[model samples]
Target chain A: MSTCKTAIRISAKAPRITILPLIQRRHESSARRHKKLLHLPQAPSYAPDRSAPSLIFNPPSSSPNVYHTPLKFLPKDDKRRTLYQTALNLSTHAALRRSTSAIATSGTPLTTSSHLPPRPSATLPPPVRAPYEKKYHLADKEIEEIRRLRLSDPDKWTRARLAEKFGCSQFFVGLVVKSHEKAERVEAEHERMRTRWGARRRAAREDRSRRKEMWGRDE
Target chain B: MKRIRIARCGTQLLAPPSPRRPLCPHVVRFQKTITLHNYRIQSRLQSTAAAREASNFEIESIVEEVESSANDFPSSTWTSPRHTPLELLPSPHPSAALKSAKLAALRSRLSLPPRFPLQTLARTLIHPSADPDPTFNNGSLSILGANLLGYYTTEHILCNYPRLPMSVVFAAQWAYIGPKALATVASEWGIEAAAEPGGEIDPGLLQFKRLRSGDDLPTLLKGKQAPWKWNVTMTNKILKSDEFGSTASRPDAQQLQGMPVPIEEAAQSFVRALIGSLYLHLGRPLTKRFFRDHFLSRHLDMDKLFDFRTPTRDLSRLCAREGFEAPVARLISETGRHSNHPVFIVGVYSGKDKLGEGAGSSLNEARIRAAAAALKAWYLYKPLEVTVPSSTEGEVDTSKWKPNMVDCGEVIV
Candidate 1:
C-alpha cells in the first residue's frame, strides 16, 4: 500500500499496438491450458457460468487490448460484481502493470484453492506489461517450468498450467519461469568445459607464438 | 502583371460619323450576298419605315407569309442547303463582282431596324482548291462556321480573310420564330432549308418566308423543345461544363434548382448579331486584312475571352505562347514561323487550377492541350510563326508522341 507517487514513468513511444493480437492468441492458449489444469472429472451440479470469466474482465468501452470481461458471466445475478469491478479497476490503472510481473511468475497459486489462481494477467494484452514484469510467489520454479516447456513443446505451455503443475499462480509462475530458465542455462554451460568459450583467444595466441619462433630461426 | 490585350476592344464600326448620307446600300444588300466568302451573311439593320409600322402587326404578317410560302412548294424542296463549300480553282481571269444585276431589287431586302444593322452572318462551305469556280471574292468579309470551310479553302481564304461574326439580327418583328420560318419558306419555294442544325438556311426560305434562318426556330420549339429557354439553359449548361467529365462532383445532381432566364442571353444574341452585320458591311478588303493581320496575327489579345465576373480560380487562368510549342520544353519538330505566317497558340484557364485546368490531365494531357490551344490560336489570330519545325505533336505521348497530320497554319481572321 505504498501510495507515495511512484513516478510510473511512461515512454513517449507507448507499447506497440502489435501486442494486441499476440495477447489475444496468448489468451486463447492460456484458456486452453487453464481448462486442462481444472478438468474436473465430474460436472458441476448446476451449469457453471461458462461465460462469467469473459464478462468479468471486459469493461464496455475499455481498451481493445483487454477483451475478457471478468464479472461472473455464468451467474446472471450480480454476485461477483464487486470482485469483477476490482479486477477491472486494477487492469486499467496505469500503476498496476509495473507492479505485478514479480508476483505473476511464482509457481504456486498463493490462494491454495483447488481452483487455479487467475491466469489472465500472465497473458496480458500486448499494450500491457510483459509477464516478466508481474509480481509472483514461486519465482524460481516457475522460471524453470517456463524453460522446460519451451525446450519441449512446439507451441508454448502457458503460465497457468506451469503454475498449476508447480503449485503456484500463473502470474508468479511467469516470473519464475523467465528467471530460473535463464539461470539454469548459464550454470549448464559453465559446467560443460570452458574451452569452447576460450577457443578464439587461445587460437590467436598460438598463431602469434608460432610466427615469432619462425622469425627467430630466420635471424 | 503581364496582361494580354484583346483587339476586339476597338471593334466598334458604328456607321462611322456619317453626316446624313445613307449607308452604302450596295455593299449592305446585294454585295453582301454576292461576296463569295460572306454570301451567307444576313442584315441586322432596322427598317426605314419601322416608325410607321405597328409593332404587333409585323410579326403576325411574317407568320402568315411563312405559312403561305410552305403551301406553295412541296416537301421535297425543304432539305436543300442554300450554299456549298467553295474550293480553290486554277488561276483564271478576274471575274470579281462589284455591280450586281438586281442590285436595286436586292437593296430592298435591307429592311431591318436601323439600330441592329445586319442579320444572319453565316460562313460558306468553300475550299480554297476549288475556288475560281465562283464562291470566292478577293475583296469581302469571311464568315466563321465549320460548314462554310467546305465552300472555300481554309488555307487560301480563311487564312487570308478576317474572322467575321456569325449572328443574325432582323427587325425583331419579321425575325421571331426559327423552324417555321425555314420550314414554310422551304415548302413554298420547293427547296429544302439547311435542315442540318448548322447548315445553310435555304435562300428560298428568306424569299418566300420573309424570315431569315435560325430566326423562327426558338419560338416554334414548343413543349419539351421549349423547356430550355435561352439564358436559363446557358447558365445550367455552363455550370455543368464546370463538372463535365469530373468525378469530384455529380453534374446531374447539381443541376440548377430553377433559375430564371435573364434578358442577357437575348441581349448577347442581339449585340452579336449587330456586330455580324457590321462585319458584313466592312466587306472583303477589311475582312482579308483582318484575318491576315488582326484576327490571325501572331499576337492574340486574350482579355476579350472569359468575362471578369467569373471569379472562379479555374476560369481565371490566362496564358499565351509566341511559338506553336510549349514555352518550357518547346517540344515538337514543327514550330510556327514568322517567316511564313506568325502562328500563335493561346490558352485560357477555367475552373480549378488542377489537372485538366489549363490543358493537361496528365503530362500527356498537357501536350495535347498545348497542341489544341496552339491550333485554335493559330486559327483565331493567324499570327506568324518564327519557325515551324518539320515535326509536331499529334496525340498525347508523355514519353514522346507526335501528330501525324501536317500541323499547318490555321488562319482565324
Candidate 2:
C-alpha cells in the first residue's frame, strides 16, 4: 500500500507541459491579452446637475423591480425624483451627441430639432400581395347569383374559387354563401381521420387541445 | 252581569238560607260572587298541577302581571305555567351569554372592549341555518358585514394597485376576503364549531346545522349556471355579479335558513356577522382598525394573481395607447447555444430605454417572460403616498386628503 501511494503521487506530479505544449500556453495567454485589449469604452457619466432649478424629462420604464419607484409614483417633493430625471437627461444628451456625430460624418442633413427621432412614415410594413380596397360595387343581384352558384356546385364553387370569381376576399364569399351538406361532409371526413389515429397520437392530440384551453389562462 | 246572576242563583240554591247573617239581597249577592270567584281559582290551580304532572319536561312558572284589585291574592298565585323547555328554544337566549365561559374567553381573546356586549357576540355565532329566525340569527348582520367587507376590500385594492386588470382585481379580492379566505381566517382566530347547533350549545361555538356526510349540498349553495351562456364580459360581471366577480350570485343567507351548510359557509357567515356587529357597536374607526389588523395583514402575493396570455402583444398595445414607443424584444446575452440546456437573457426595449429583462432556456420564452415582467411592473405601480376614498369618510377635517390617481385601466389585447 505504501508503494502504491508513492507511485500515485509520482504520477500526479508528472510534467503537464508535455500534454499542453509551451507554444499553446503562450498562444492562450496572448488570446486572453487580446480579449482584454478588445474591451469596449466606458459608458458616459450620468451625474445630476445640482444647479438645475426645474425637474428633468426622465420617463419611467416598464422594468419590474420591487425597490424601484417610478417618477409618476414618487411624491412631488421627493429628492430621488429630481435625481432620476437629471440622470435620464444626461443619458439622452449623450445618445444625441453620438447620433449627431454619426450624421455629421455621413453628410446627412438633420431636419428635426426634437429630442426623439421622427416616427416612421408608414404605420404598417409593405404588403406581400397587391393592396386590395373594398369597392362596395357588388349589386344585390350579383350577390344572389354568387350564393346560388356556390350552393348548386358546393365542391366546385368553394370559398376560395367563389372569392376569385367575384374579385372579393374569401371571408366575404363565406359570409354570402352557406351549404350545410358540405360542412357536414367535411366534419365527417375529419372525424373518420381522427378515428384512425393510434393511442399515442390520440393522447398527443388530446394533450394539445388541453394545452390550447390553458392558453387563455396564461399557465 | 249575566255570569254574576247565574253564580248568585247557584250559590243560593246550594247554600241553605244564611240564618246567621240575616243578610239583605245585595249582601247575599256580593257574598255569593266572592265565593264563586274563589272556587274558580281553586279549580284552575288543580288543573295546572295535573297538566304539569302529565308532561315529562319541567315547566317553569313565569310571573304574570295582575290588576291591583286582583293582586290581593298571593304573588305566587299570579304565576303562569310555561310549557316549553329552555333547550327547545331555536337559539340561545340573550341572557345566556353572561353565563358562558367560552363566550367570555372569546370576547377577551379578540381584544374587544368591555362595552361590546357579549349578547351581540353570541348572536353573531348563530348562523341562519341554526336559527331560521332573522332576529336571533346572524343573517341580517352578515349581510351588512358582507357589504362593508366588499366596500373596504374594493377601495383598498383600487387605491393600492389602480392599474390591475379587472380579472386580476377579482382574483385578488377572492384571495383576500372570499368565502374560503374568510373561513380560513375564522379557523385561525381559534373558532370551534358545535357538534350540533341548539340553544343548549355554548354561545361561543359557531352554531350552524352541519351538513351530514355524503349529503348533497343545499340548492342555494349548489353551483348555478352563469348569467350568460358564452362570453361573460367584464362589464356584465361588474354590474351583475358579486364582489368576487363570480357569474353566479351569492346565496342569500335568509334562503339558507334551516338548510344544512358546510363548515366553511358557517365560518364565513360568523366572521361577516362579527364584523357587522363590531361596526354597529364600536363604530367606524374601530371596525376599520380591526379590518386592517386582521384582514389586510394577511399575506397575499399580488404578482402571482396575474395570469397573462399574449403578454408581448398586450405590452405593445399598452405602449401604443399610452403614446410610448413600440416595444422591441432584443437578446441581451446567451450561453451554451449548442448544449441541451441553453440559457438566453432577453430585454424588451421601448426606444432607448430597456423595459424589462428575463432569462429563460429558449430565446422566445425569454422574450415572452420579459414582456410579461414589463406588463407586471406597469400594473403593479404603487404610489409613494396614497389615501383611499374610505379614509375621508365621516372626517371633519379634510386637510390631509390627497386625491388618488385613477388609471385608464389595464391594456386590452
Candidate 3:
C-alpha cells in the first residue's frame, strides 16, 4: 500500500500575487531570528568565561550585551590562567562553607605546574602566628599568682612582664589580668600606642573604603 | 466584531437539558418532547410560528437557516441533565468562542493545535474570583498548573546550579514563576482583563473580581504579621512550605473562589491555567517547550541577588574549610596613597594561588572587596552539561541522558 500519489492537473491561472505580503513575511522572519538569538540556549561553561572579565572590572553586567564583551584569551601556560582559575573558585559564604564538611574535602584545585614559575612570596607581609606556648602549661595556681602580682602593682607588673615570667603569650597575660574596673585605663593606654594618623590621612582612608564598598556592588 | 444573534440562539439550542425543572412546565415538557439535536429545530419551528404571527421578516429568514442546519443532523431523543440559563451563567457561553477574534488570534499566537478546542482555552481565562463554580472557573486547572510550574522550575534550577545556597535557590525560584513573574508573563502574552465577567462578555478576556484600590490583602495571602521563628530550617522550608520556600502557607485556591482578588493573583492564575490546559490538551513535550520559551527565557543576574554582610571573614573561613593555606589580603598595587583619593588594589591569596582581587581607595576596603569577589567565584560554579530529571521521565533512550552533578549544597552561612 504505497501512499505516494502523482497528479496532473489542467488549471485556470490567476494574476501573479503582489510582492508586498512576501516582503512583509521576509521582515517578520528576520525579526523572529533576532528574537531567537536573544534567547539562545547559552552554554553554561561559556557564561563564566564571558562574565568573568566584566565582573573583574565591574562586578555586574551593566550592559545588555555583556556576553558580547571579548575576554582576553590566555595561553595554556599563562600565569594569568592560574589567577583566573583561582578567582573562579573563590568562596561566596563563609558560614555555609564552614557548616558543611566541604571545607577541606571539595572544590580545591590541584597544584598544577605553571609555565611561568611563581615569584617568591617572601616580599609579601608575613602571616601572624600565635606567640603563646601551649606546652608551658601554666598551672591554675600560677595564673592566679600572675594576676595577683599584676593587680598589686599595675605600673610595675605589666602584661609583658607577667607573660615573660609565666613563659606564656602576652595575650594570655592580658586575658588573665583583664578586669572590668581597669578596662578604661587599658583602652587609654592602647589608644596612646595606636599609630595616630592626621585628619587628611584618616579622611583619605575613609574615602577609599567607601569607594571599595561601592565597587562591591554587582550592579 | 458584530455579535451574531443566531450564534447565541445556536448556543441555546446546544444547551444541556434543563435539570428536572418543575418550575417551567412548558420548557420541561418541550425538553422531554424533543432530543438535543431536534430541540433547535423545534425551537426554530416555534420561533417561525411566532415570526409568521408577528410578521417578522428577519426572524423568518434566520429560522429558515436554523431549520435547514437542524435537518442535516439525524434526530435522536438524547438529553443530558444540566441547569443554567444563558444570561445567568458565570462565564461566557462556549458558542461565543469561535466568534471571538481575540480567542482565534490567541490560539494562532501560541501556535496551539487545531484539535485543542477553544472552549478549554476560554475556560482558562475565568479565574475562580470571577466564576465561583468549579466547573466553569480555572481553579482545579490552576492548581495542577502550579504544581507543574514548580516541578519544572525547581528541577531546572537544581540541575543547572546544584550548589546554590538554599536562600539563593528560593530567591531564583521566586524570580522565575512566582506570582509577580507569572503575572508579568500573562501581561507579556497581551492578555486583557474584562471590567466585569458575564455570559455576554468576550471569553478571550481574563475574568476576575478585582480588589478595591487601597484595600488590604485578604487574610490568607497577607501572611504572618509577626516574624518567623528562628528555628525555621531549609529542610523545613523544602518539606512544609510552598515552591518559593516562604514560611507562610499559600492561600487556598478554592477558598478564594468568588472573592475579590488583586490583578496579580488573577493574572497568575490565568497563566498557570493556560499551562495546565496546554498540558491537558497538548501533552508533555509541548508543555516543556512552552515553559522553556516563556518562563526560562527571562533574564535574572544570579550574582546580584546575593547580599553579604561580612565577606572577608567568610573568605577566610572558606579557605580554612577547604584545607587551603590561610587567605592573606596583600597589597597588589596602589597609587596616591598619600593623596585624598589614594587607590589601593588588594589581592586575597590562598598560599601561592590568588583567589580574587579588588581595587579601592583604602587597604582595608580593597581587602573586603577582594574577599567578596572570591566568595562570589566559589558560589557561581556551573557544570558544562546537565540533564534535568524530568527530561528523562518515561523515556526509553537512557543512553543520551547524563546524570546531573549534585553538589554538597551551598555554605550554611
Candidate 4:
C-alpha cells in the first residue's frame, strides 16, 4: 500500500515541472537590486556634534524667539544692535561654506541654508494701491470747505460725494468732518432695534462687546 | 491693692476669732506658722489679681509709694510689673514674640536679620479687623507698604518699558502689585491664617476676621455703578483712580474693624504690612531687594497684557504721530492656499525695514496680527541699562544717572 501511494505522489509532481517554461523568469541579481533600491538608510540622530561650539543651536522649548527684537527698537549704544548684525554675517559665511563644500563634492551648489535666506531682490507686492499717494494738495481751506459742505447739507454732501468732489478718500472726508446729529440718530435707531432683540440675540450681542473689550486685555 | 484693702477689712471684722485662737503659746506658734503659709498663698493670688485688674487705683497707690520713698532711694526700688492676661488684651503682647516658634520660623524662612524684631513681625500679622486699635493693628503699616509697593512697581514698569500705553501700564501694575497678586504672593510665602483672630492665637498666623461661607460680599467690594453706566476715561483713570486704575477706591483698613473680610483683603494687608515693617526695620536697600526677589521675580509676560481692537488703524495713527512712513502690511510667505488649513505670514513694514511679522490662518488675520505685533513692538521697547527713578532716590551723585526717554505717549485712535 505504501509503494502504491509513493508512485501516485511521483506521478502528481512529474506534470508540474513541464509548466515552468510557460512562465517567464527574471534575473535574480535584478530582483536583488530592486530590493536594495527600496531599502532606506537610517535617519541621522539630532544630537549635537561633540566638537561643535557651545553656541546655542536649539533653545529650550517655549523660549522666546531671538529675532523678535527689531533693529529700530534697539538703542544706539546697545551691544545687541551689533550682535544681530554679526550673527547675520556669520550665518551667511557659514551658508557660503556649506554651499561651496556641497558644490565641490556633489557638483551642485545648495540654494539655501537653515538660518539665512537669500536676500529678496524681487519687489514685494504693494501694500496699498499702486496709484495711491498722499496728496498735500488739500489745505486748511479745503478742510474748512469740506466741513462747511457737510454742515450745511449733510444728506446732500455725504462722505462719498465729498470725497468724489475733493478727489480724496471717504476716510479723509470723515476725518475732516463729522455729523453729531447723524451719530445720535443712528444711536437712537440702534437702541430701538436693540429693544426688539430677543434674549438670545441680546446675550450674543452683549457677549460680542464683552469679548471685544477683553481683546485689549489679551484675555 | 483692692484685694489687699478687702483682706484688711475682713481682718478688722473678724479680730475676735484671732483672740480666741491664742489659747496656748505653743499652739499660738503653730497658728502663726499657718497664718504665714496662708499669707504666702494670698500674696500669690494678690499678684495675679493685680496683674489681671491693671486698674488705675493700683497704679495710683504704686505712684504714691514711689513718691513717699523718694528720699530713701535715688533709683527706682519698687518694681511691681503688671502683665495683662492674653485673653483680656485685644492683640498679642510684644513679649509673646520670643515664645512663638512659628514667628521664629517665619523670620528664618524670610531670611530676615536678627535685628528685625519679631515684635514688629507679630504686629504686622494683626489685621485692623482683628485689632481695632491703630497701635496694635497692621493698618498704618499696610498703608505705608501699599504706597512703597506702588512706587517701586510703577518705577520698574515705567523705566523698563517707557512706551507702554496707559491702559497697559495700569494692567501691568495691577498684574504686579494688585490685591489679587499680593494675596497670591502672601499665600506663596507659606503664610497660614488663624481659624479666628484673637490675642491668644499664635503670632505667626495671619489674624483677620474671616468672611463666613455663603455670606454676601461686603458692600465696599461690590460694584458701585451699573455696568452700562460705567464710562471712566483713560485720563480720568490715570488721574483719579487707584494704582490698578479701578474706578472704586480701596477701602480703609480701619473701616473693616470687627467686620468679616475676604481672605484676599486680609492677605494683601499682611503682605503690605510686612513690606512696611521691613522698610522701617531693615531700611530701603534691603526692602528693595525683598521687593525684587519676591514680587519682581515672578513671571509676567508684558506682551500678553495687550488687547488690540484696531491694530491696523492704530499702527497708521502711530506712524503719522511719530513722523515715520505709514505702516503697510505685505505678505511674506504662505502655504496650502487651496487647502482646508492655509497659513499666511505677513510683515508690517514702515519703509524698507520690517517692524513686525505674524502668521495666521488667513490673509486678513495675518495682516491684523502683523499690525498688532508692530504696535506691540513699538510699545514694548526696552532700553538697556535702565536705572529706575527709585534706585537713585537718595544718591547724591548725579553723574551716573541717565534720564529715561519719555515717549510722546501712546498712539490715540
Best by the lDDT measure: 4
Candidate 2: C-alpha lDDT: 0.72
Candidate 3: list runs displaced more than 4 Å. Answer: A1-219, B1-86, B225-231
- TM-scores (chain A) of the candidates: 0.17, 0.50, 0.32, 0.58
Off by over 4 Å in 4: A1-67, A75-79, A93-98, A101-131, A136-166, A176-219, B1-85, B220-231, B393-400
Top DockQ model: 4
Instruction: Give the alpha-carbon lDDT of every model.
Output: 0.28, 0.72, 0.68, 0.73
User: What fraction of the correct interface contacts does each predicted structure contain?
Assistant: 0.00, 0.07, 0.12, 0.30
lDDT (tens digit, per residue) of candidate 2 on B59-84: 12211211222324333433332342
Q: What's the ranking of the predictions by DockQ, best on top?
A: 4, 2, 3, 1
Tens-place lDDT digits, model 3, residues B92-119: 8666788899998998888887767777
Candidate 2 runs further than 4 Å off: A1-83, A86-219, B1-84
CAPRI grade of model 3: incorrect
Query: What DockQ would you assign to candidate 4?
Result: 0.21
- The model with the greater TM-score, 1 or 3, is 3
Ranking by TM-score: 4, 2, 3, 1
DockQ, each predicted model: 0.00, 0.09, 0.07, 0.21
Tell me, by TM-score, which candidate is best: 4
Better of 1 and 4 by DockQ: 4
